[model samples]
Target: MTLDDPTRRRAHRAVVVAFLAHGVVSGSWFVRIPDLRDLAGLSDGGLGLVLAALGIGAVVSMPLAGALATRHGSAPAMRWLLPPLLAVLALAAQASAPLTLALGSLAFGAALGAHDIAINAHGVAVEHERGRPVLSGMHAAFSIGTLLGAGVGALAMAADVAPRVHLLAIAAVTALALLAYRHLLPAAVDRHRTAVRAVPPTLGERLAPLRRRWLLACAIAAMASFIAENAVGEWSGVLLRDHRDASPALAAIGFLAFSLAMTVGRLTGDRMVAALGDRRTLLLGGALAGTAWALVALVDDAGVAIAAWVVAGLALANAVPIVFRAAGARRPVGPDGRPAPVPAQALAAVSGLGYAGGLLGPSLIGAVAELLDLPTAMLIPALLAASIALLARSATGGERLPSTAARSRPAANASPTPTA
Candidate 1:
């Protein structure tokens, strides 16, 4: 089942398509939330609950998605879920009650959870097959797709398109695009040394890895990075409008600038990683992000803060992808004295923590803003982002400067060591 060179290249393209598709689905869905709320007949409070339902579903499914990928192979598991995931988007558009809308959101979140893990699992495999840093480009595709989907959704709204029609159209188009391009790497490519668990590990066994310095560092670093990212997307506009005295229209540009900078940063991230190496790249990114956030918080001017936000976006761009690179790099030694597949559990542990940070970080900042002030609360992300530097070595297990690929090659039969 090993992919030949042609198939490997194709799989790499497929993985990029998958990431883009997922991002489009997400971006399109977020833009239509107001319509969804109207269709569901919800107040702001009910909308919050429905939103919470989505997080709950993601929480519940993330681990389960990892387990499914472990058992069935990420390739097949991804294929199985694609249709249902898109279908949920269409179905949610039609939900006419609070409960039904919540349920549909829950379904959508579950699908998202599965979709994320499968794609990452498959993506890491593809990276291995290619002997280069590829995740950054894949992530860039996602960022670009988000922008594209958001634009489409905005246009749909302007055209007075119904939610049902707009969302259904997005769902159908995304599904077709993914299926048409999904030359996914065979499950065997990643499964070569994996020992499929016949029974689930005990609670202690599951918890044991968290105590590992590397895993703990990875989790903290990832959570910190996500908090910074979510903060940029969620709170930048508020910071612009309320604190910086910007017009609403001008305030909206904060996140757009951030997103655009992120897109550009990730598009060039692979080159940076190759030139500077994982540990150094993260260290520099962390310092830059921390400085950017600090400037945004401390500066009184809107334009200055917004410009700093762009710097923050650029700094945060490759941070999480590098963390994931470490998490998926070389496999642990299995019982047979060979490199095992990267455990799917890593998916649950890493992404689950990140999901929590993304969900809670904005709320936590908002709470602090309520209790104190917006500018003061903004400092929290500055501190959190700075912590990435402190945690970088542990997170990356000390990747060499200038990333010498031959020095970290994987076991026989697998491709070169990941650039992480």
Candidate 2:
């Protein structure tokens, strides 16, 4: 489809809506973790284990979701997975026992993992159709949704609203969003299958790309980025309240600042990529994120620490998306003249490993905090962000930037090799 096609435009809007709903749902859960911990009567270590269960679920489900998307197209897979995800979200919110909550979290995480891959795959497809950068903008919508969700969650906390009520409201909104955008998603037939029409690969072939050097590098970058991002989302509020003596209402401000900065960064990310290219953006962003974390580790003032969180958010906003775009850009022709599972498999592998880092983050931090202190524990993500800065070349992939003229033209008419 051409960039000017009205259908393509509608699809773009649909994807943005989907992303927004995703962000709201995610933010609603994340912002309420402190409350949940209290409700379940769990220690920090216990809560960390619950969070780790969620990550494990996501890791288990992501590859299967990717395979499904590769076969049946992203839109259908997303449509099928979303309602169950919403249900699990509500279920998780209602759990009173630690075991029940952990089980609910596992289910919730599985749904989120599958839904994430499908939605991202759809976004990549839309980007290909439009022939310009849209993933960052779509992610911006997610950030905005999260910002709104977190803001509203904070208000609810201040008003003494119950977690069940708050989560149920989010579920209702998510359901409405799905119904509104159901028809706008691209049809399964509209998706571009691999160039060759051979039978699908066996499981071994589907996973072959995991051994490639470039794909492994991309996975590591994704892991480090997630470690940093998830650390802020999961711990920022606790740090503010426990370490900085902020009130519950005020504690939410830390994540709020981070999400707001992320939204701004993503909204402008396309232009930045256009000017500086992916490598430089990753390097610069990683440096900024690393510095922010370092400042947070050293700074004693709560307000200054919040500012550091915002700076970190702005810097790391585009890191994972850049890696994803690079993964999507790779399209290897197989010996049978069919398309290999390079992009889809690479996305799943990287996302699974990356999510593992996110899963480990809370527990790791809690353990470190028990031994040392929260500020000292913050140093781990700081070091990881610095590692990302040093590893920025992984995103470059030795590819030339697409010419402006080429980018503006219809991608359908372009060569088969994908563009990042």
Candidate 3:
């Protein structure tokens, strides 16, 4: 109920650490992409294929990860999945050929996807048990971790450290963090156990939430948000450099501004959600992101475009978190009156679609840019953001939890009568 509760405190800390670890490993890998490309002597198309392996792997594993979490609980699933992922990261760092990189990317992506679902499941469960909004702050930790990892990687690059050495260091640190926080994770409980033991539902029944209109809408909204976010991450620098003729150093500023805005927005997201409610937050965020993109599309000034990117990041910061929280909270109840397939399964479905959109968005933008122009191609995410705003209500399922103090207060009219 409160941080004074040890279990709650520990769970919260563990979840944050888990998120940080995921981000650190991912950021470290991302920063070394150019080096990896050079090492493999891959052309742009070859590199694209190698990166695609990662997405393919992630898409395939997301549902399976959800199933594992549902059966064994998030803690055990995370504990079991993280080591392999770390190993894969190390393997990827050592990759010397296109084929090896692609294979490593596939394994790395699978591990990352599974770890993501498990950690998010843990975060949602912790939030529910604590009975207050926390998912946003947890996501903020992830953003911070990413920035930290990227900073570290940049420093390593400046020092001319080998990719293998850098990646090994990241793996070691991540492993240490995992070991340190392992005890704090929520203990695994077999959801199958009951006073009267029940058989697990069939796969069809477990996945029934996928057919629900509300869930489908949430997934679509998540996809739209992801498309916007990934577009900025992947193409903002190019847009500035190629279109605006900004210097290389100046061009990098766009992504930096975007990342900082995202981190700041998420850090303060809980208060906003408490004040505005999920529906309002989603509406405002989507509108803000759409408007920012429109500004970027309409304006030609580099500085103005960078500022727009920052606004876009801030606006889009909480979109995915809101979608995930709603999915976990509103999972369908089974025939036995228990949540079917579990929250993780619903999260996985949403995340899978989002990941697909994220991976496809930049490539789609590139194709459209070739067909039309970069500015016009950029309008696609703006439109997507507007769609998210229009559909915010349906996406969030209208679920709103009261503030902590409100939830903790006893009803005034329900005071207990004096007992003899």
What lDDT does the true structure give each of the candidates? 0.73, 0.77, 0.73
Give RMSD (Å) of candidate 3 vs. truth: 5.9
Provide backbone clash counts, one per model: 0, 0, 0
Please write out the lDDT profile of model 3 over residues 364-401, one tens digit for every residue. 77677767778788898998987888878776556553
- Cα deviation in Å at residue 416, candidate 1? 12
Off by over 4 Å in 3: 1-4, 34-48, 189-207, 237-248, 330-341, 369-376, 399-420
**What are the per-residue Cα lDDT tens digits for candidate 2 across 1-420?**
233567778888888988898898888888998998888998777877888888888877887887777666778887888898899888899988899889988998899888888878777767767667778898899899899889889999999998889998888878877764664545542244552235655555544565665566667888888888878778888888988888888789999999999999999988887777778888999899999999888887789889998999899888877777766653344222345344555677667677777766777887787778888899989988877777788554544233211454544434444211
Winner by lDDT = 2
Model 1 off-target regions past 4 Å?
Answer: 31-52, 93-105, 157-165, 192-194, 201-207, 237-251, 298-302, 333-341, 369-376, 401-404, 407-412, 415-420
Q: Against the true structure, what is every candidate's RMSD?
A: 4.4, 3.5, 5.9
What's the lDDT of the predicted structure labeled candidate 1? 0.73
Model 2 alpha-carbon miss at residue 266, Å: 0.3
Superior by TM-score: candidate 2 or candidate 3: 2
| Ranked candidates (TM-score, high to low) | 2, 3, 1
| Count: clashes, candidate 1 | 0
